[model samples]
Target: MAVDLEPLDQALETAHLPALSAALVHLTGETSWLRPEWRPTYTPLSRGETGVPEAEQAKMRAAAKAAITAYLTGKAPMAAIPSPEVLHQMMNFVAGADIPEGYGDFLTDELAIDGHSTKDPNWSTPELKAAARKLNVLVVGAGMSGLLAAIRLTQAGVPFEIVDKNPDVGGTWLENTYPGCRVDSSNHIYSYSFEPNHFWPQHFSTQPVLLDYFRGVAGRYDLKKKVRFETVVEEMAWDEARSVWKVRLKTPSGIEHVEANAVITAVGQLNRPRFPDIKGRESFRGPSFHSAEWRHDVDLTGKRVAVIGTGASAFQFVPEIVGKVASLSVFQRTPPWGFPVPHYHEDVPEGMNWLMEHVPFYDKWYRFWMFWMVTDGLLPMVTADPDWTGPTTAVSQLNLGFREMIAAAIAAQAPDRPDLVAKIIPTYPPGGKRALLDNGVWLDALKRDNVELVTDAISEVTASGIVTADGQARDFDVIIYGTGFHASKFLWPMKIKGRQGADLHETWAGDPRAYLGMTTPGFPNLFMIYGPNTNIVVNGSIVFFSECSVRYILGCLKLLAQTGAAAMEPKREVHDAFNIRVDEGNRLMAWGAPQVTSWYKNEAGRVTQNWPFALVDYWRATLAPDPKDFILTKSAELVE
Candidate 1:
């Protein structure tokens, strides 16, 4: 087949210079593109935007085009996996910074620079296949994490069933049909590491796009057949004797009970929307609904709309509904810090998408760049310095640097409105709460003639409207609660009983702790995907965490297959020790500061929802399961 080298000229022009250069090394098997001038400038809060001059970038692009063209035209050979040292160099070159020491291999595996998902298990042996057949896993939720579990299980020749409360796949994405619900992270990295959608329209894909992506993945894996849609897991009790989970499922028809050797809870933390317990919350006779459950049927056109909370959901939806609403009164408890992302909602350039598809390693390198840029974002923002003294908005000098830079960007959003700026700026630290991606439309929406930013505490809600603490009662025809989710509730409403009739929720007592945010001490053969402390804020996407978790769960199952154990759970000492380390790490993080409050923390004031360490650390820790850290229980069948 004749190749198209002519189009490479134009496509190379739109290429991310750093990713192009790194990819050229693999495409042409040449090291010349790893030059100093080809590297990007390490700018905070920006994807790899090469600060090299246009002339230099052109030279690099020409070089990349030639290299890629050679490979396409059968003149060059794809380079084999580079050495760890070489990968470390590429990491630094692509990131435009010295990646912290001992992260070379971790980042290499995480980036999957060799085009392989590190998490996908291979139970190749007949013995392993027989072992897999013996274990039927029950996966709760057909969302991103659950679908990943289903795919991996299918790949490993393991039998499994997936159940989701929703009618289809895509957990949150399928559920949240708000006006402007979109991902805050870059879509390239936000997606599954195994399934890279080079043709993603937007940098941050909207809900429908994201849902389509997940739905496509589900179809690709033929996972929907294994799924019980519109079915909910009501109660799952562990049978200590049998070493199986007796699951009670509520289907569209009626309740049904089933048993599985293992259960992986992929029902995420943020599914349940947490409505603020204001006085007379139910008194509002107006059509009120949580942002997660957006009322698409109720028209908001030219109606007085009251949006409660200014979190990520509001940040996206308000911009969409502001112009349509007659008046938008945003009730904000604490303002979110908006990170300036010029292309947050912009579509990928046609040429860039072309490069990603045609160029050998361009997509991988580009995805790696996005992953690394926000990889250890919390290291500076969350890690409090002992010697530093700063305002409550900042805990350390590095933290202050991020806060000021983002704050300045946010302030510039409403340059003419001093009053809006005063209300928009958060008093807490930048990492204290979930930061939102803004393309300047958020401020534009807030600065609208009909939009009013209400900072005063909500006193109560009347039959028709909301009452402020300042004795101001505002009427609204529609109330949208963008108030965040019940993130602290690990697995709520559903009943999960561990060994010895121990209740999962009652055991945690509002402070959910899990080893690596997957397995707890008592829940044998029961794993969690987006479990406690697994949520990422500044670091990376939850997909990454879910991938890591699912991988870890596979490793655990592999450990069980080898040990001939009925089930295994993290040792109590190991679980407690690991959580101690996590809590200590969170304590040092900026989010752990006493003054700041957010969904990351529980009612008892413990940081229970976020991973306090770098993304790489979690990746490394979940690579394999440690048998020594687990307590293996011999099943009655195996014992006999």
Candidate 2:
């Protein structure tokens, strides 16, 4: 019932220094760094510290290999270890950060490391079986969060239906197939905790592999059976009289209506591509498209390409197309902070693969190592230091350190051209916007004779190409916009009505706020995954946030089933109070810096699309549903 230890074992045998050091700490609850005799040949600051004396390196490698071999050969059952000890290990792995009180519950519920053995507390009780049977849940979107919801519902024996506009289950990944499209998050830890893939060919997997992975997950969980592919939820109304959700769906054949006791909206933020509102956009006679809706059939060979918005997507695809295209112009509003990752495009080594296949618990331990490093390691840097005076550079001293590191990386890219560095280096805080991972590919592409970095504002688009504010009109055969998404607009273009005919859109007026990023007042029996204020900016993977949100939704469903409640909604006061806390927390985060302007905020300057707290804080808040924070209406049968 526990997470298989095979992956972790394999990681240990591979002796990947960081993974091994983290695992040793986690497994033994050790606060100190690995002993020199057992340390791997690498450290964070210095790569390939294999410069260690031959005898010493051999001794350490042999000792580490032997230690992992013992676990793989059944001498050690790591899963059999107690939970408290594991918690200790987790804390030590996170540099001795105090474990939150709700962490144990978070581990079992959100992490679900026991490979689906742990059921929602409400469904686990026999008394709720009848009520649970009556539950008909509708999950909108068959993407990552939607798949998780469907799997959990099936495990809880609840009848549910998933509707996705996409023909397949990959959602964003399925739609985005631009050249060089890939995941920014580490593939190993970016996946479902229970279903780890040790065979990721690259540390940062490409779009196709990610799509296949999601499709594979859907198949493994038997979720496709419950999914109505190419179906979109047009509108959903809360039928207060019936205490159910009346969902209007648009399928391939025709529109259909269904009634569900509960609804889970898993439509995430990244799907909607936001095209810049530029003059003469319609005048562009060339084959113009958003990067997400790439036209692969159109050949770019010897063609002049005009790419707009140098964001994450632009950073990726520019390097790929620079060599193939004849002339390339990259338009930028603001340059992003680039974090240098030397092996960003490197394939996974064979030795690492061998350890993953052969060593026990190795993959699991390595995934945990990644989780801790990315999740908590970057959090402190993003938090605002009230007394710190630096504004244009960074929000805090820790953030200044990050800024310096990224600046050095930019300098390394174009060492001779201080002009290029000045244009490329961001003036805002490091985590104010997304910090892109680079290995000089971006700068190298910009340095190409065929490539030009255009920082001027777009004056207008001509029939053949773009006209910049510098009054120069450059002609191109193609235009690609990498301007990201309408992230702050949550549940956009969907008409959702709740109690008293309260419209979801009108309620927020373009600023969406949900209680714990799951439920909103007046919307009974409705839950959201990847909702407002839940996006991670500085720390953790979006997948992790989705899991946390799903767990919270499951907890709500449990409460409704166990209590035989006709409806349950967050109290208005509670919802408002939670949002107030979110705003305050965001004020103390770099993303909320006054000079910073990004998609994370709404028109009113409210930070609507990010989680400002540490991952553990979110986990703690969503461990269980607080009955007092909700208004529950008992069912007629239960009342009788």
The positional error of residue 469 in candidate 2, measured at the CA in angstroms, is 1.5
State the C-alpha lDDT per candidate. Answer: 0.85, 0.78
Off by over 4 Å in 2: 1-14, 21-58, 71-122, 635-640
lDDT of 1 by residue, 466-547 (tens): 9999999999999999998888888888999988999999999989999999888888898999898888878488888888
**Residue lDDT tens for model 2, 270-345:** 7889999999998988799999899998898999999999999999999999988999999989999877777778
Question: TM-score winner among the candidates?
Answer: 1
Using lDDT as the measure, which candidate wins? 1
Residue 46 displacement in candidate 1 (angstroms): 2.9
Residue pairs with backbone atoms closer than 3 Å in model 1 (clashes)? 382-590
